[model samples]
Target chain A: MTSQSAAVLKKKSDRKKMGMKARENVYQGILWIFLIVLALTMILPFLYVVILSFTDSTAYQAGKLILWPEKWSTEAYQLILSGDGFMNALKSTLFITVIGTPLSVIINAGLAYMLSKPIPGKGFFNKYVMFTMLFSAGMVPNFMNIKQLGLIDNYFAMILPSLCGAWTIMVMRSFFQSLPVDLEEAAKIDGCGPLKIFARIVIPLSKPMLATMTLFAFVSYWNMYFNCVMYITSTAKQTLQVYVQKVVLSSTVSDVVDLSMDLATTVPQEVMRMAAVVVVVLPILIIYPFLQKYFQSGMMVGAVKG
Target chain B: MAKKKVKYKATNKTLRQQIYEFRWIYFLGIPGLIILLLMNYMPMRNLIMAFQDYNPHLGILKSPWVGLEHFQTLFQDDKFYNMLKNTLIISGLSLLTFPAPVILALIMNEVRNAKFKKFIQTSVYLPHFLSWAIVASLTFFLLSTEQGFVNKVAEMMGNEPTAYLFSSKWIYVIIVVQSLWKSVGWGSIVYLAAIAGIDQSLYEAAKMDGANRFQCMWKITLPSIMPTVMVMLILRMGTIISVDFEQVFLMNNAMVKQQLEVFEVYIYNNSIASGSTQYSYTTAIGIFKSVINTGLVLLTNWITNRKGYEGVM
Candidate 1:
């Protein structure tokens, strides 16, 4: 009797285990479907752009929407890359990113370092910083101020106004606060003053936060269209993003059909627009992987411990 | 050691020791203060431009005082009502949709498989890296009248294709949907961090009490992240009047002008109009906007506080 009862109990437990395993499998299947759908949404448009860039002008004119191009050609890429307009804009974008990002990171880091220390009138400075974040004098005054400062129509115009971002400084300050004081104290005892300690000891240890700030600043400066439009009047000085804007705006045949007859045969408007986008975006996307480790880890360092 | 102590005592006897003690503290503040004064405080003096007929030639002090004339003109303008309406509608829709990321994060936290969670996360984050210009172009290609993917699919189904972008009726809806698609993944990062910080022992304890995954999520997960959600909601409410100027400006045309004419774009239009460089008038409108935004943020925080969570106020 005891052996028979034990066998029945074992069977019941095995059935429960089987049921749990089935549920787990079902959950896994649902998760896979969700992820696949998300992946398609994220990647399909980019793929579409690439596919259209290769399609010939004749195929584009015929309104063919085939994913696999009926007539694959490199006319769009050849036109955009070989053109003087694309090259100048590309150069301006790279210049802005390289010059503006480091300037911002260094200046903001100096301000952050100062604010992070336990010093006299620290509360006064902190409040002043917070005030800027909450309220600004708005765009028109900012424009006038920059113009008066003689930054308009100049590269410094683009870089200076955005250099000392309040949020970034605040983030860096909090990040510095979270670092142990012992590291800096030891350096101080070894004949290092504040500046030397910041340069020699603190900076090397703060690579992740610095990297995150650099990437953010680089992207912001690279993608700046408003500053280019507002301040930059010369066609030659326009950044890539602003150029992309102009291209996309004028690309539709309906808008520019009356401009000229010769313009119609230059290239398919859709292909040119896509090619510009690809050029504008490709560099940043390529650089993103290098900063991926910094982005995921450093973004959270000083965000919300409070 | 005795000689060193004697030297220290000689320095302490002098006024130099007292000065040195406080010197480092004051020195640390000057660089940051100089930047703040130059960048932030100096521009604040320009706020006075709102009260004057500001002219570049006359400068701030020499510009004619206009008193409330600019504010009066701003109120009388026909576009003011429409601009304010559009701003509120777009902002309200965003507030409604902003919680989607938080919901997504909660769902993600429930996933037992680590690899699948990472896949979904990495894929969702791609759109945040894309600029509004690219996003707008993508939308146009997908929703264009004749050659768009959506229209093509509709044509295949024996139905007429609807003009999605040009339709005034659908413009706001399109803006909200686009905003959601671009930001939902990145916005959820904060909520995910808050979720991850929740104690693992809570989940273990719940499991031991016969609670299943769904029950644990409902009873433990949602409550744990409520404070972060409240803070984010309060902060978003603070910027209610501000719109993503880049996205709307890039996407909009004459077709959907009525629907898509947000306050930011409205300001841009006024700035660009011939002889519309009335800096005072523009400054007045800007001042009004900042006031309204600040008031709304405070009001929302008040509401949140009444609900018993510590709001941003």
Candidate 2:
């Protein structure tokens, strides 16, 4: 009788274990479904914009929306690209991003390298940068200072004011400090000076950090909006983002259609807006994958140390 | 002891001499220092405009002193109070979204499939790189009443199309949703890093004790990343007054202006966009924002220290 009862109890425990395994499977399945749905929410909007940009005007007006367009057309891209406004704005944006990013990286890296060394007044310099990070001069005062410098309505307005960012300097400084002092000492023992060590030894080893900083500066310059609106009063000088804003906000479908009627071709306002978005976003999207490898390590350095 | 005193004096002399030796290093920093002075410090000195009438013709130095008149005007303006209220409400709504990224990070952590996890991360990080202008345009395309994707979905469900941007009731909801969409994925990155740093031995032991995945996450992972979450929360709290100016500016329209005008927009409209400039009054408002921001930072830092978490400062 005791052996028979023990066998029954063992069977019951085995069944319970099977039940728990099934429950775990169900739990994981639910979690997967939830995450995929969340990711779809992120992705579908961009997909919609891309699909809508390709859809012909007639189909779009008929409300025939799908993941893929039934009748694809390049009319929207042609119209926007042909426009003087779009081309001019694109040129301005490219110029700023290309020129300004390198300039910023150089200045910030130099200042950071200086700060990282155990030089005289290093503590004072560190405090100076930190204070700017914590406090700001407010919008009006900064605007006033820019005006006083006669940078209003100038391209230099975009580049000059943003040259030295305290946060970027801090990040670069931390990265510099993380390097081995022995390497620098060795370079100095071999008759290398400060500038020589910085140019040859320091820079070559700091490529990943410099690349990340450069990417950040590039992105910010490309996305310049508020500064352009405040500083560049001329329509010809406005960057792509500001111009896109003007187009998206000020124009309607009927207005675009009427304008297009004169040119013997019809461009829907929706399609034009989507095309503008693609144009503004395309450069970043193209370059992102190349620079992505540095992002994880770069962010680690910034977050862990800073 | 006498010999040690001489050595200390020798070191003091070397320190001063070192400054002269490293003069070139200081020169390397000079350009950046000058730029900071021109851009950051100069503006701070221009905060004196807050107390003056600040006429462009008279210049900053010659502008008549208004004393507390700008402050008095700010205190009495009905629009100022309304804008303040709206700013607080918007900021409060955004603060509610602070945990979204943390939750997302935790969810991502649970996925055992490495490839799928990476795909989701890459896809989600796409939005962070898009400009606010593009985001606003996308929002309009997806939410507009006439032919928006959302409206089409609603129509298929036998519901009337909703024009979200035009409705005052829906503007804040739209703003909050847009902010979440833009930031959640990018923000998760830091938390994911923190989670990655957790000891794998703890998870192994949890499994030894028969803890399920959810149980392991709750009992082990969440508690492990609590300090990171607290630090991020404190930093966010410090900027409670400042909304994303570009997002607010681009999303705002005449119809939604009443509900959407935060301090940033208010400052722009009064001082920059308006035909008549109220430089002093606007400067006063800016000062008030700075003070409140600094105070909040100190307050949160003090509270965090009291709670035994590391303070951000």
Candidate 3:
């Protein structure tokens, strides 16, 4: 039971390790290399966008892979910003994200909280929501309905149509149900009404989940494309995504002649596209690391053991 | 906000009392229900447009009823079949690659070094946050005939520059790769969570039984996460008829447009694109697709349940 037996056991396992260690090393080594390469592939496209955006026209004109620039330049940014359409798009995108996110979170939280309660008709309510999750009306009918609501060309067309979805509500309902009921029980005993208990105990206690939902709503609103396209017809109401798509995918730029010979010469289309890509994604990239845990936690809810 | 509400005194409340007690909660749910009614249910009601001659001035209700005419057009149209085929192929290819993240997650679970694992996770997850617009731009930069990074590198290595952007040959492959790159990391989170929820004791027991690392993973980790894998598979299969229009549309060049005319893109083109608004026909097309998707979901859910796992539905 003491040092002598321990020594024998250690030696026995040590010998086994000696044989298996080499194979394990190879396995582990290959795993690491495969993962490292996979990670780099994910990262490099974004890096490539950022790098090419900043690369001076000279390096770009070299017809070589521009990994690093001899001289970093902001001409692309200057040119993209110089366009009123791009600026308008950015402003509207920002407007949608700001307005949509808070409204979305509150709606989701309220509906989810009510679902979490032992309210009458709750089961029917759940099924009703779940039905929406399973089958959505196709875009045309949905567009017609939105148009009938007088949301066409309206910002609410973008915001209201997709403000709260059933899948999100279900996920959030689970979150609410997972919250400790003891606080509510105590609040009830102290003669605190349901609203008071929810406003005080539930809201404060569920900050992490709320934060995660907030970020998700924010991201969805920020990345919104389908709604923006279907609902908002006017260029003035178009979003960053629409703007970026026009800049990035449409090779001819629609009216290249209007680009002006001087501007085209100074800042080529490719570089401008790269810069637009960066501008569109910069906020997410900056906040991503800080909010990464929230994302994981939200998904892994009720799954984590330790 | 209601200051005059009295404290509950009843030990066993009647239905009326219970309903009255929950009134405020019901009040909280009003705005959401209204939104759902307007945004979701109203659209569903307007799905009647698929059977009618939808004239905007007439509105959906007053529009002339043309039962099954739009549906007939949808089925008879060659473009409809083409769109359906493209949608199926793209979604099917993507669904086949769904397990990529599961494999990645398993490999990730094997890494002993926490820091290195964190680095990999962080790096991989970033791509998911990128909007389709950025990915499309990135694709253009990679595939551009002359100044593209890939072509430039190919030229530097004395290889021929392939017409990646200007050709339809690689459109499907391009879509698959783009989806994989964007989703694999985010998709793996669920599998990783499943792996995390596996009993650690099972692994230790496997180790004690002289099972090697691969043996342990195969016998223990793999079997443990099967239910989760099944659930995910069923869920994915349900939506296999629908493809992401944003990604396909944004990535579409004239070269690839014919090859990549998915249902959503077709709808967008006919109903919402500049100068076209064939609402009745497009509505019929959408209804047909959604019906197929919904049927697939129910069918897959029942199959999964028959196999003894809890159904995703």
Chain B, per-candidate TM-score: 0.83, 0.91, 0.90
- Count of residue pairs whose backbone atoms collide, per candidate: 0, 0, 0
Off by over 4 Å in 2: A1-24, A62-67, A252-265, A298-306, B1-16, B156-158, B302-308, B311-313
Give the per-residue lDDT of model 1 (tens digit) for B59-125: 8989899898888988998887888888889889988997898888887776778777876777677
RMSD (Å) of each candidate, 1 decimal: 4.9, 3.5, 4.6
Q: Interface RMSD of every candidate? A: 3.3, 2.4, 2.7
Give the docking tier of candidate 3. medium
Error of 3 at B300 (Å): 2.8
Candidate 1 residue runs with Cα over 4 Å from true position: A252-266, A295-298, A301-306, B1-36, B273-275, B297-313
List of clashing residue pairs for candidate 1: none
Best by lDDT: 2
Clash-forming residue pairs, model 2: none
* Candidate maximizing TM-score: 2
Flag the better candidate by TM-score, 2 or 3. Answer: 2
Candidate 2 has an lDDT of 0.82
Candidate 2 per-residue C-alpha lDDT over A81-178 given as tens digits, one digit per residue, 9 for 90 to 100: 77777878988988888889999999898899989987766778998887777678788888888888888888888887788889899888978899
lDDT winner between 1 and 3, please give it.
3
